[model samples]
Target chain A: MPDDTTPLGAPLTTPDGFVALYRREAELVLRFCTRRVLDAETGVDLCAETFAQAFRSRRSFRGATQAEARAWLLTIARRQVARYLKRGALDRRAREALGIVTPVLQEGEAEEIERLAGLAPLRAALAEELARLGGDQREALRLRVVEEQPYPEVARSLGVTEATARARVSRGLRTLAASLELRWEGERP
Target chain B: MRILDELEREIERVAHAAGEARPRRRWWRSGALLVLAPLLAGTVAVAATTGILSGEPVSSDPHAPRDPNAGIGVNAGPGKLLAVRAADPAGGPEWGLRLVKTSRGLGCLQVGRVVDGRLGRLGQDGAFGNDGKFHELGPEILETSSECQQPDGAGNVFFAMTSIGQPASADPASCAVRPRGEDKRPACPRGSLRDVFYGLLGPEAAAITYREGGKTVRQAVERPAGAYLVVRATDPDRRDVGWWSPSVTPSWVESIEFRDGTVCRPDERPRRHGRHECPLKGYVKPRLDIATRAELATPITVRVGTAREKPYPEMDRKSLERMEWQRRVTISFRARRAADARSFYKLTAEIPGRPPNCGVGLGSPIARDIAAGETVTETLWVAHRCSGTMTIRIGYEQQTAPSQMPFHGDGPPNAKVGTARVRIP
Candidate 1:
């Protein structure tokens, strides 16, 4: 492990540490915040605020591991996103202030590939079918797929046991597969 | 499948762009010292002690201390403390300091400026700095300015330097106290809420306290709401009570009685220490946070309840209206600190009146006192009914400065209900 004490002599300056920290984690933080909130520009701005806060409270770090640092910073990002919600995104000023500009959902080549590969069609059919499942099963799929978090992490974060998490994912996936098969057959000539 | 991949890639791309585009160096001068110096030293020291003078093979610095600061230099005297400019025009009462922890053991700094405003600490690890709009850290950052301006930042920013001397302690009791009189009276409800309302709303001086019983004996409890209601202890006879008032509404509420068996009550009296009135016991209030449905809700509807394959069968609006349905919805809330008491809050739907077809089949009680920086979520159930616009109303009552619940034109004679509209299937 790198010497944790190194930051002690690091300029202890806001801009310097901010630049370093941002370079290291801004992308992940931005992507995470973007997924949580609406727009990318706002995500950028939130990224700035997250670092600015990290800069201000530099004293809170206890020389933990790099992974721990990432978690700490990400945790802060989470709170900021939550605050955005509290202030009510529906309000015009807040929306503007937070840079919550919703970017147009443009179509791209990757989407075309999935469509051609049949995975896209399968997933859609699966999703539609998945909706036919219970809330727990659906939630399992959404958390695992959309959030892209591991089942264990998702379950822990959502306050459920790992087994329950697996069950939700299992049940959801099964329903999707069944639904996709049925839909595909119905569409076949 | 393709759309998800594309979305993920786009997200990653933008995130990467942002990471690359960020300023390569720290903006604030003081923050640089604590975060960067160590890394540089480790490299230099490793190079020097290795005696690579004779073109020796570079070896990992085995002696490098576990912590980089182990061999780093320290400022001869008090370090250069970063100063922030106080909000101009006082940021219009919506401004305060934003503290982020970059290094451990950073001393607490005081806020300074002649805004004639209040200061409190943000109780939670709130996020900040997205396009200048920062996250809410709750109201705990409102402590006294530890030091005045260091002849820099134009005194807008306060600093903490041993050389300069400790920042003067502004009585937290006074600083946290809301200027509104009627609102503050509830903790020590000696005067009528009406009297304090008019007296404090204006420029006149007043204070209030809103305190709840502590979960434990040792942990000092914070007041319950935002700046609206604070807890303070004061003499019963003295008219020291003042309510924490929000800019929006100014009606005093003592307790909230929900449909379930939950009640949230704020202290009604102020406690005093010597001549200065200290904040009441349950003075620390929890900052409110709301997560919108669309923020977390998905357009696709899923089946709920039942063990069958079609627990949440897709039903057109008409079909949903036709069926006898039990709709379940989940809502989550977080607080910066412990609340005054169990909030008997009500959730209101935007749809006016009970629609002929829509009705709340069941509702759960959220009576737990939320601690600061904690997130809590609960699910609520309602029956689907064929009706015009279907909505649910959620409100809470507490003896804080005043209530944030909405006033239904159809509330009880003396009831105030805050409404949060939800879509009914």
Candidate 2:
């Protein structure tokens, strides 16, 4: 984990600074979108738009910490997702004005989204079950899965051993699976 | 796989666009320091010394000639006038003079460097058209100007009257501004008409033949390095010639056997005709490999089908058509490991054709791990269109270490383990 007090040597207001930020944060942003959208194609498009919007307004980014910068980017991504859900499609004109080349959806992507839509209620339940886990376990799982960090790095960041990190992830997955299974069985009855 | 590749490319594109949109402050700040400092100092000094700080219009001398070219003198160098003719014979004297005056900044006799039977390296001297007289010369006219210079060494020097227009494309190879017209009048005083042939050929060529105007000329190659060969013919004047490399088979030859075991034929079209014509297209075999010995714990056998399939519904037709076509290929492979340990292999497939447009998919490399002695069959979608042969090559590499974070820069080098090639129609 980066020291919270460490200042960003160069601000992201410049193009080169923004490029460095993109290189560091793009994969994390993509993984976040993938988990939310449940489809890789839509997730990739949203990631492009997210960065495009961030770049256009990069001068306005006044954050001093990496966490604040990340939070700022995620806020933009959340708005992008909301707009996408509300409009049922991406804003082509807005993307074009910002020089983003919009990608066409691949085959079966729409169908995948529709299929994942049916599990919306279960997703809410899963979120609740995730909150039920211990704070350490939840944090470990979030770093390893959502942020897509490696085990050793996640362990070091969370101030735990590799074995402890692995155990927390395993326990979290098992708990989520069990809760989902119980929910499905209850619905069947 | 294609979607992943497109996604990676999109990320790069968006990052680049964002960078381009931002204003570059460093360049402007540096430029201001370098330019403004000198200008500010000079302006302050001139204003203080001359006492002309108040704004006033500068007056011009009434006796000066209004024409920009009035005082320009002809300076064609010390070389004698070997030969001079209008650069554009069809444009007549008036158009030629106008072009020469405009291009050289003054109408005068222009000299050029005659290299390999071509005229270039133009230098001008004296005003010619300003006097409203077209300088005509018969055979053997002497030019005695000290300003006229020749190309370094033994290169021949040529001269031509100034013309008004320049060639549309200034690339020397395609430019048509030849000396003394295409009829081949002597550019140098000593009848230096020659034919120059220059081009690259395959390393296998043993000899080349020049066939032009009912005459045949041949040259032997001492060493073939697959480099450019320059064949010159000392004919007073000749521009058209047919070049043939007998030992070098045309790419369209499709099928030709050599005693040295070189495959000089397209694998797909063995019996195609027009073997004498040049091949319209070519292919580059992709690099496929498994990186290191530890990753190669198991022996793998890969088989790729030769048949072609239509593109999927969501795949853009116009995009595929630009590449010529799309071919869905099926790849099957079997791997067997001695130990029960898990192993991962990287598979890369590249179809040589038109590159995908912005936001279009180009397939990504696949990294999959299989159990010991397990066999997996997978289908790969590839773009399949080109005027020439389309080649598809696959390689496998093993992932030795855990993937790094940020994942932006070049990946760890992978050692190639196995490769397969498939050509499609």
- Kindly give the stretch of ten consecutive residues in candidate 1 chain B with the minimal lDDT sum: B122-131
lDDT tens per residue, model 2, B32-81: 44564454434321123322221111112232323331122222233222
For residues A45-155, could you state the per-residue lDDT of candidate 2 as single tens digits? 777778777876765565566766777788877776655543346533334334334455568754453343334565688789899998988999888867878889989
Q: Which ten residues in a row have the lowest lDDT in candidate 2 chain A?
A: A91-100
Give the Å shift of residue B290 in candidate 2. 65
lDDT of 1 at B224: 18
Residue lDDT tens for model 1, A107-181: 563343333334544555555676788887777777886677776897987689998897777677667656655
Q: Put down candidate 1 lDDT per residue, B343-392, tens digits, no spaces.
A: 23333332332223322222222334445555545554333332333343
The window of 10 residues in a row where model 2 chain B has the poorest summed lDDT is B401-410
Worst 10 residues of 1 chain A by lDDT: A91-100
